[model samples]
Target: MLDKQVCRNIKMVLLDVDGVMTDGSIFINKDGEFCKSFNVKDGLAIELLRSHNILVGVISGKASAALDTRCKHLGFDEIITGCKNKLPALVDICSKYNISPSQIAFLGDDVLDIPIFEKVGLGIAPVDAHCLAIANSDWVSTLKGGEGMVREFVDLLLINKLDLPLKDIYKPLLDKIRYDDVAIMEQ
Candidate 1:
């Protein structure tokens, strides 16, 4: 967990889609189309972050319809895709927001994302991420990517940053999970 002062300094959270958002897998269907699955837990976490008025954005090195669809559905504040050089995009975002890199937090899970760690205030990686990513991250998530990783991360942020009660912040996410599980069981 980040210290209270450091967490309070964060204003935005940027995510890399392939590994940070998903399991770093891109499946091509028989029709030669790509597809990806997202965890509801991650989605809810993003929603919670948004509800707090914290900006949420996705920056992907590759462009995909799936990425566009997911970002649109999730109402991301910013979406940058098809940019291999992430530093420029990060700079652009900082320029647009009139904020310094130190005000941003980046979640990434690959070697390419290493540069961001050096730039952002807080750099985080999913548990099952690349070794380099883990090595470079300021914090490594206990949960695997696409397996409620964002949820846990957000919970930490809510608790540490705004001083929100963890029990209160966690209730909404946990309740949704329970409801979804029941729906699955009823199926």
Candidate 2:
């Protein structure tokens, strides 16, 4: 069980892009384009989180237009790409928000993400995450990445946690995406 106080105190959510969001697959097309899959439910959950005033963003070790495209579509507060080291980014985010590690939740799936787990208020992992990731996580989702795992995490923390009106559910603002480029999940 998550400490309700911690959940209540959560002001931001940070997610790792590759394994945690897309099942760790990278496909390159013949046209020299990169491809990755994103869960729409995960996107919706991120929208829901943002609606409730919880800032959400992505930090990736690798860079791709796919990440840039998806994060932009989702209206992320911050998007930091090409990060070989994520802890410094984490610190910058915390500093930008004037918040402590205790007010943030981080999701990751590999050894590279260990530093974030060590410092975040809540460390969560997908079901298929690396053993080291699971060990350091404060919570683990039952679902795999790109398979509603992010939704599972959101539900745990904010399903019925908000006082959202039915109207908000009917027409979520996050559904609006201004896609100047081709915006679709890659597989």
Candidate 3:
């Protein structure tokens, strides 16, 4: 069973970009343009959750045009970057969304994210997250960042919040293949 408190209180999901979204890799070109790799599964999960009326946002300490472009493409409800003090940003997000601190869920993987984590209802940390962050989280994913960690969190939320049938969501994709096809695909 999911936490009843979490299911009841969560109204918004906020994320930190570097560690939470991209495994904390800052790929800088010689020209100083930075890029990051995001997991496709995580992106799809966000789309599905947003479609179900849950608002999502990102609050990152570092600003990047790549992040802006990605968030725009993904249709994130809000994106507040270059946030040195995350608590104020959280406060602003809560005020703008007409939500309370208890109605927010935040995902983070570093020390800088702890303030926001402490203020939100559902604080999430990835498997390989900083030790302090993991200790602070209400929940921790089994997967690491830039893997399927976010998707795992999304699955839990879907199961509890929407009571969505897990089988119904993925059965078609699974049923399309034979056992031999699965073996072949694994190869």
Candidate 4:
């Protein structure tokens, strides 16, 4: 269960990359390039959050081109990588956004994320997250990372915090398609 007050206070969402977004898997090709998989549903969820005026950002200890491409595609408000210590990154995000710590919700999945859990208004962990991370989190998702967990969390925020109905959450997106003459299928 999520604390409605805490959820309502969230103005920004921060995410960890490896575990929270990519199932904690890192694929290195022969050329020393890294590859990662992201859930399309999570992407849609992020788009919805952004549409509703909630800022989103990413923080990771590792840096890779794949991560950069994904963040760019999502149009994240902040992207901080190669950060071994995420506390400073949090501070930077707060300062940059001019949002208080109590207005931030972070979803992370490792021991490294515990310190952040303590500071943020809402700390969320995926079902497969580290035990300590789960213990510290304000809420735990039913799904694992890279498996629509982000979508699940977003739905909760939309419905419980923002008072948007689940079915109506797609109105903004659907309206665009309906009004823009975008073809969904070719005859």
lDDT against the true structure, each candidate: 0.87, 0.85, 0.83, 0.90
State, as a TM-score between 0 and 1, how close model 2 is to the true structure. 0.86
| Candidate 4 ranges with C-alpha deviation above 4 Å | 182-187
Cα lDDT of model 4 overall? 0.90
Residue 117 Cα positional deviation in candidate 4, in Å, after optimal superposition: 0.5
State candidate 4's TM-score: 0.94
lDDT ranking from best candidate downward:
4, 1, 2, 3
- Residue 143, candidate 4: alpha-carbon lDDT: 92
Summarize candidate 3's per-residue lDDT along 42-153 as a digit string, tens digits.
Answer: 8977776675678999998999988998888989999999998999888888888899988888999988888888888888999999999988888889888889788888
Candidate 2 wrongly placed segments (more than 4 Å): 159-187
Instruction: Order candidates by TM-score, high to low.
Output: 4, 1, 3, 2
Model 1: weakest 10-residue lDDT segment is 168-177
Q: Candidate 1 lDDT, tens digit per residue, 37-143?
A: 88888998898887677899988898888889999999999999998899999999999998888888899989999999999998999999899999999889998
Q: Candidate 4 clashing pairs?
A: none
Residue 118 C-alpha lDDT in model 3: 84
* Cα RMSD of predicted structure 3: 6.3
lDDT of 1 at 72: 95
Q: List the residue pairs that clash in candidate 1.
A: none
Best by TM-score: 4
Tens digit per residue, CA lDDT, model 4, 67-149? 99999999999999999899999998899889998999999999999999999999999999999999999999999999999
